[model samples]
Target: MSKAHLPTPPDFLIKEFASFQPKDRQAIAIKVAKLERKVFPAIEHFNYDVELKKKNIGMVLAFKEDDTDTVVAYLVYQRMKRLVWLHKLCVLEQEREKGLGKRLIEFLRTQMEKGGCQIHLWVDSNRKPAMALYKSCGFQQIEYRPDYYGPGRAALKMELSIGE
Candidate 1:
């Protein structure tokens, strides 16, 4: 990705959910899990209980500045040295087109740049809006895998190099 600046949406406050108290984090996890099921296909849905316990995994959630308890969007990623794998990015259906997705990507990029990490992800080819969002954040297409999702669905592998 280019070094161009990416602006965060001012209405939403995004932060790593790990910093919260165990009880609060558990509450957010339940909401996130429910949101994931509503937004993502079953094939792509993750088990937040198991995923949240990983040391390498990180979850960034976006909440309305006025309402810290409700999650409006989220981005999940795994970092290992200079490589970061972006696992999932989702915004509640009612919250789409408000730049939440790009904001989350920019947030991750800015944080990972300190360590010169390269972010990688495979987006389902059928999701045009998602592809556009990532591309807008300067993610370059690296490869295309046919039938990666199923018999007809495909996947596009993309990457964004941060300060590398």
Candidate 2:
């Protein structure tokens, strides 16, 4: 990835992460978990409550200011030293092609770039839309793992190194 040029999507419905109160925290987690379950198959489901409780993991959710209950998209990541591992990136089926997923990724990059030097994630090779989205954001495939998701579901390890 070129440090000199980072792709920025048009300002879309991105509500950058915010400090959530205790109640808000649980509410958001449950909401996001629900969204994940609806969008991803059971095999790919995550325990949002447990993951968000850890210190290094964080998530960014996008929703309309007027209707926060309807979560349009979310990005979950785990930070380790200078590297951030993207756990999941999901946007509602009704919300695709609107640049929400890219914005969520860009939002995460902007939030982590100061302390984090790179972002890495394993994407299911069968998921073409996801592959395209990450590639559009300058992530390059670093490795390929066959059956990482299950037999016949290959996974691609991709990375984007931030400016040094």
Candidate 3:
């Protein structure tokens, strides 16, 4: 059997996942679990709605590979009182380092530019590459939570001020 070919650049779309169906939610859960294994094995399960609402959020962006029409990654965020919060983000392993994550962040920042809001994301303290990417994209470390994710995992809060 041949493996499915992923979509190429300039042919994908970013969609908002407003109401995830049972199947869609299951798929997302499985993918998130896989990612946790690689980056945050200690967190057994993640409550989607809790994360979605806790940060005063609104929408979740799903990057859909056009050719295959599959959601390869997702970014959950919220805007509150002139501040934007990126609650969670994850890219499929095959899609990493291809500039997709940066593109999503840039898109959000562009939207924030009109509103004059600052953007922030919470990254696992051990994710050095992600930290570097955020810093390279002009985000600065603003706060740290020791064992914020548990006894071993820490949370590093990074922010980018835009339209100020």
Per-prediction tally of clashes: 0, 0, 1
C-alpha positional error of residue 62 in candidate 2 after TM-score superposition, expressed in Å: 0.2
Any idea what lDDT model 2 has? 0.81
Model 3 TM-score is 0.70
- Candidate 1 residue 6 Cα shift, in angstroms, is 11
lDDT by residue (13-98, candidate 2, tens digit) is: 45534455666787888888888888899988988767777889887777765676778898889989899999999988987998
The runs of at least 3 residues in candidate 1 whose Cα sits more than 4 Å from the true structure, single-residue gaps closed, are: 1-7
Cα lDDT of model 3 by residue, 34-115, tens digit: 5545644555445654654453554444455454335566566788878888866667778788776776676666667775
Per-prediction TM-score, please?
A: 0.92, 0.88, 0.70
Model 3: residues >4 Å from true position, as ranges?
1-9, 18-46, 49-56, 60-65
What is the C-alpha local distance difference test score of each model? 0.88, 0.81, 0.66
lDDT-based ranking: 1, 2, 3
